[model samples]
Target: MQKNSSSIKSSTDILKQAIQFIGQHNITAIPINYTVSYEYCRGHHVLLRQAIDQAIVNKQPITNEAIQGWFDAFLLGYDLSELNKSHLDLNNIVDQLASTTTQAEEDVNQYDTSLKECKDELNETLDTSSLSSIVSSLLTSTTAMQIAMEQMKQQITASQCEIASLQDRLALVTIEAVTDPLTGLANRKGLSMAINESLSTALQSKNYPCLLLLDIDYFKKINDSFGHLVGDKAIKILADTLKKQLKGKDTAARYGGEEFAILLPETDLQNAWKVGENIRRVVESLRITRSNNHEEVFRMTISIGIARYQANQSINDLIELADNALYQSKNTGRNRVTIFETKL
Candidate 1:
C-alpha cells in the first residue's frame, strides 16, 4: 500500500488540481497566473490547485469513480503541514469536478471536439455547460461546509497529540511518587502499598501470599574495602538483576539501605521456595568489577527469608515474620534462603 507514496509529490499534485478545478467553476474572480500553461504547475501556489493539476497529468479519462479515486489517493498521503487542510479540501473538490467532467465527456462523446474544448474550459472558465454545471456546482455549494470540516479535523488531531504528551508526563509523575531513584526500585511507600494489596487479595481469595525480605550480607565491608562508588554500583547491579528475575505482577523494592524486599501475590510456601532458590543462584552467579588502576572484581550474595501470611494475621505481622527469617538467614551462614518457622 505504501509503495507509490511520496509525501511531497502527492501533496503537490493535489494543490495543482484544486486551483484549476476552482477556476473552472467561475465561483471566484481570481487569476490562475496562467503563463506557460504547464508552468502554472511548476510554481508554488495554494496546495489544492497543485493537487488538481497533478490528477490531470495522469491523463486517465475523468469519471466519477476516477475523480473519487484521485481525491482518496491524495488523502492517503501524509499531511505535509498542519496548515494544509485547506489544500486537502481543495484536492477533494478537484476529484469531484474531475468525476463530473468525465460523465459530461462521455455524454457528449459525439462532440469529441467539445470534450477537448470542455477540458480547456476546465483549464479556465469557458462556455461549456457540463464543465460549468458539474465542475462549478461542486465548488459554489460546499465552500463553507468543506472549510468547517477541515478546521474541525485539524483541531481533533491537535487534541490527540496533547493527550498523548500528557499521558507520558503522568507516568513520569507517578514514578517519582513511588520509586527509589538510586536503585530504580520501589521505595518504602510503594512496598507498603504492595504488602497491603497482596494481603487483602489473599484474604479475599484465600490464597496465601509470600513475602521475601532480603539484605546484602557484609555490605559494609565492601564499602570499606572498595569505596562508596563501588558500593553504590554493587547495590545498583543487584537491584537490576533481581528486578529482571521478578514477574510483572511481583514487586521488588529497595526497602532501605542495603536491603530489598519482594512481594509475591497468590504464592504459597512451596512456590516461594523455588523463587528464593532462583534468586539465590542468580545472586551467586554475578561477577561485579571495580575500576582500579587496571580492574578489580567484587562479588557477594544475599540472605533471603520467606514468610507466608497466616489466615488472620495483620500485614505488619507478616512483614516482621519475614524480617525475622531474613535475620536468621544472615546469622546462620550469611548467604541462603530461609523460611520462617512460627511458634507452635
Candidate 2:
C-alpha cells in the first residue's frame, strides 16, 4: 500500500510570502516588523488579527503604535512556540542517542561471543587444515567487527555535529523570539519568564521581588508632533536610559509602546522606590537631538510606579498594584514616582 504524505512549505517560503504581504500593504518599516505581523495574521492569530481588522472596520487611521502593539502580542506567542519546539527537539535527540548507543553495545556483545566461539573451535581442532579453517573464520569475524566499530564511530561523530548545529539554531531562535527588535530589550514573553523565575526564587524564603511600571510622559504628543521615526528614536533613548540605571539581577523590559517594566530581585519597598526615583531622574536628564539638525533637541520625562511582591500573590496581582500606583503618578503629576501601599 502506498503511504499518504503531507507537504508543508519551508521557513524560506513562508518568509517570502511574508515579504509579499508587506509589499501588498505598502508598509515601509523594517522587513522583520511586518514579516512577523504577516505570520501572525496568516496563522489565524485571533486576537491580533481581530485587533487590526477592528481598527479598519471602525475607520481608524492605523498608527505605528497600533500595529506594534498587536505585533508584540504575536511575538509573545511565537516566542512560546519556539521555546516549546526547542525543548521537544532536544528531548527527541536525547532519546534517539540513547537508543543508538544501546544497539551499538548489543552489537559489540554479539561480536565478542562469536570471537569466543571461534577460539574454542580452534583449540578443539587437532588437524592442521581444521585449525587453519578456524583461524580464517576468526580473522574474518575480527575484520567485520573492526569495520562495524569504525562505522559506529562515524555515526556518533555525525550525530554530535548535528546536535551542535541544533543547539546553535535553538539559541539564535530563542534570542530572536524574546527580543524586541526596536529597543534591543526583552519583549513581554521574556519579561514574564524573568518574573516567574524571580518569583520562584523569592518564594524560597529570600527577599521579595519588586515590580516597577514606568511610562513616558506626553508620549502621544511626541508621536503626533515629530513623526513615527522620531518617535521610534525617543523610545530607543528611553530604553537606553533604563538600561543604564539597572544594576545586577535587575531586569528592564519594553512592556509596551511608551511603557516599560523593571524587575528588581531581592529588593524591598524602600530600595525599590529609590531605584524608581533614580531611573526617573536619569531619564529626565537625557536630551535627544534630531539627526537632521543638531539645534533641535527633544526633552522627555517619565512617571514610575513601584510595588513590592507579596507572599501568595500572582504576577498579575503585582502588576495590578504597580499599574494602580503608576496611574496615581500620572494623576498627581508627571515626572514623579508612586508606591503602592498595601492595607494591613
What does each candidate score in C-alpha RMSD?
22.0, 7.8
Per-residue lDDT value at 91 in model 2 = 51
Write the residue-wise lDDT of candidate 1 on 1-344 in tens digits.
24323443355454445446535533221111211121234344345346556657875444444444443544334222322343343344444444445544454453455445546767776557766574555454345445544655565565455445434433454555468879989988788878788777778889988999998888999899877888888889889988889996899999898999998999988889899889988988887775655364666799999999988888789889999999999889988999998788
Q: How far does residue 103 in candidate 2 sit from its true spot (Å)?
A: 2.4
Error of 1 at 19 (Å): 47
Local distance difference test, each candidate: 0.67, 0.76
**What does the lDDT come to for candidate 2?**
0.76
Which residue pairs collide, candidate 2?
Answer: none
* TM-score against native, each model: 0.51, 0.73
CA shift of 328, model 2, Å: 1.7
> In angstroms, how far off is 188's CA in candidate 2?
1.7
